[model samples]
Target: MKSLLTAITTTVLLSACAHHDDVRPGNDNQHYVVIKSVDRSEGIKEALGQATHYCEQSQSNMVVLNETIDYKGELPEHDYLKTRATAEFVTEAGSWLWIIGDGHVDDVAAVAAVAGAGKLHSMGAPYFVTVNFRCT
Candidate 1:
């Protein structure tokens, strides 16, 4: 009985620390792009720039749908929890509208990355980026 209780407690704790899925489905015209880096702020900045470039190429206005930052390492030891901070980065939205709008690229992910990058800016931490977009 004691072991069973321990197992249940452990399971609960692990689940609590796990990362949540941040992805959301856009319209049928939506697309997604993703980027990851060890530098948080820089990663976001790069993502935003990429998004802007895509918008320029497609002549579409930039619209950010979502942004998130997540921890990339294992749960810290109890003693280290106070002193250790997990590396983090952001993922912006990704959408397909850019590619379809531009009529120059068939890569949906690539186009979405542009907007994702544009939506982000460097935080000087390790991170990732995801961009989503859709046309009205």
Candidate 2:
């Protein structure tokens, strides 16, 4: 009986831990970005607030990051746009977005790095932008 209880407790704990991963401040479904440094960037809270406002106004929650972001896989178009918009707004608002994932380029820094560096790499999807913005 004791062993059974222990097993159940462990299972419950593991499940809870997994659930908590999603609750992390930057790991949620929000778009991830990787700003180059922390020196001149606004923190996440201010960016999140503005993002929430933009989302509320646009009826679309496009969460963005100010830096490079890597994700496990390719994000869908709508999700990407929403995340990108959020990232752009926050970056413009003086916040920096850092990457929260590790598989693919999902953050602005990464995109900017690639685009600026003139590297031709694709993560199974074509990302094309006619206009580009440079940040100091």
| Model 1 ranges off by over 4 Å | 1-27, 74-126, 134-136
Q: Kindly give the number of clashing pairs for every candidate.
A: 35, 16
Top candidate, metric TM-score: 1
RMSD (CA, Å), each prediction? 22.0, 19.2
The global Cα lDDT (0 to 1) of model 2 is: 0.39
TM-score of each: 0.38, 0.20
lDDT of 1 by residue, 3-88 (tens): 99999999999875432233333566464445566445665665555555555455766566655655453333342333222211
Model 2 alpha-carbon drift over 4 Å, by segment: 1-73, 95-125, 128-136
Give lDDT per model, in order: 0.48, 0.39
* Model 2: residue 76 alpha-carbon error in angstroms: 0.6
